[model samples]
Target: MKQSRLMSLVESVANVIVGYGVAVVTQILIFPVFGLHTTLAQNLKMGAIFTIVSIARSFALRRVFEAIRMRSAK
Candidate 1:
């Protein structure tokens, strides 16, 4: 089944949100293993920065793949 552009965008955004949540949760769980103790606010700040970077990376790669797909389709 093929999805429309809007659907693809929605899926991409949802993926980013899910990925961010998983990453943030993992970071909090593993922070103690690295002997770094942090407050909730601090962890959230760090997570936000990482999430932004991840979103950019994901979007860039998605665009690249989509372009390739378009070229192949034609």
Candidate 2:
């Protein structure tokens, strides 16, 4: 129980950090090249989008990690 709670907290923090990173990356690498406005509103919108994407990415990565571990054990 305690271990699960700690794991949950770690996962939550990782998601937020990854979301912010993705948002910043989009702003720097993708937005400017495409001429998208980097205003506060746009940034907020992008951040929200990134938060969702990051969560999905995290879950996908977790699955891949599990798969790799399983394959290595076998």
Highest TM-score among the candidates is held by which one? 1
Q: Which one wins on lDDT?
A: 1
TM-score of the candidate numbered 2? 0.54
Cα-based TM-score, every candidate: 0.80, 0.54
Question: What residue pairs are clashing in model 2?
Answer: none
Q: What is the lDDT, from 0 to 100, of the residue 30 in candidate 2?
A: 73
Encode model 1's per-residue lDDT on 18-73: one tens digit a residue.
Answer: 98788778888999899989887888888889877876777677777877888888
Local lDDT at 71 for model 2: 80
TM-score, candidate number 1: 0.80
